[model samples]
Target: MGVIPALVILYFTIKGYEDYFKDKKIFLSFVAGLLAGFFSVLFESFVRNAGVVSLIVLIPFFEQIVKTSILNSRLARGTEGAPIYGATLGLGFGSIFIPFSMVIYASRWSGLDIVGLSIVTLGAIGFIFFHGATGIYIGYGVKSDRVW
Candidate 1:
């Protein structure tokens, strides 16, 4: 479970380094992304209470907005490394956020429900990749001045 997220992070971090060298600030952005994920989880609990329609619509919008809020801040402005930084941040956010939720789900399993556990594990892996890919897109957008 944990290994998948770590690999995702590693893949993006390596890609970021290879494409844009010597940018240490990505680590900081990565930390911020983790915090963003934490806060988004907190915020989602509130949004989830609003009803199914809200859950289906608002939650995703809210998550994306909250996740990328840090990248859109003035701190990232004019930074030539914005894309790589964003990717790293997204990597951090996905790594911590997705696995933590899956761990909770896994803990709730009764006995050895391999099928249920397998589904949860697969979902986690899929989400990690989704988050990483989204982060890369957002990062690239920020880099090109096309994303707010």
Candidate 2:
């Protein structure tokens, strides 16, 4: 149940630009994003009670750092397709993070139904796109030597 949505988003996210970056590097970035997602889940366990501030600031800050960590190195900077890699990395993160999260948190609902599942799926889509888009912004910054 949790795996399907991420896979769909992942396929569409990298379909266009997958050829621009090396398969190995793309796979590495995806893996890195997955690892970052794992760290995020760990961090969430600690900060789940910190209120809106933690949700608005700390988690995103951590996510952005980990999302760009692969590209921050000397090897990735000034590369030809920063946006492509960034989108892939972000897609990878979202693919696992959002679905896993939604499934676990969905239990809070009284009972699961198609409508409820659909809503959660929509949230997953939005967040997956958010990560992919933000990755592009960060990637461009890394490539151009300018932070945006």
Candidate 3:
């Protein structure tokens, strides 16, 4: 459920800028997003363990920086498709991040039936769009030589 929406957004985003990215760069950006998602989990765990009361406030800052780190690298900087690449990267990040989070929630909630799972999936889809939209903005910023 989560995967389908993410793929749809990815397909359309890439389709809109189909000529901008080669297969290799797209793949690399997606992989970077996945890595960012993984690291976010680790960082969140560390923060939780450290008893950080301001974690909720800090998450957005932490996530945006970590998630877009790859886009700020030299390879991405050289590309004319920075916006497309950033959106693609965010697609990858949200694809992994949302589903992993939903699964963890489902696991913890013993009474989560199909209805509950469906709700979570729906929420995940919303989040997928949010991530993709933010990525587009980030990419646009990069392309315009503006810091975000």
My TM-score estimates for the predictions, one after another, are 0.75, 0.82, 0.83
Candidate 2, clashing residue pairs?
none
lDDT of 1 by residue, 63-125 (tens): 677656777775464566666666666666666655666656767664447777677776766
Q: Once model 3 is optimally superposed onto the true structure by TM-score, how far is the C-alpha of residue 133 displaced, in angstroms?
A: 1.3
Worst 10 residues of 1 by lDDT: 16-25
What does the lDDT come to for candidate 2?
0.74
Using TM-score as the measure, which candidate wins? Answer: 3
Poorest 10 consecutive residues by lDDT, candidate 2: 1-10
Give the poorly placed runs of model 3, Cα more than 4 Å off: 1-4, 48-55, 146-148
Sorting all predicted structures by TM-score, with the top scorer first, yields 3, 2, 1
Q: Which ten-residue region of model 3 has the weakest summed lDDT?
A: 48-57
Model 1, total clashes: 0
Tens-digit lDDT track for model 3 on 1-148? 3556677888877876677778787878777876786787667766755555547667667878875677778646756788888887887777776666666777889666878877777777776777777777777777776565
Error of 2 at 66 (Å): 1.7
Task: Return the clash pairs for model 1, or none.
Answer: none
Which of the two, 1 or 3, has more TM-score? 3
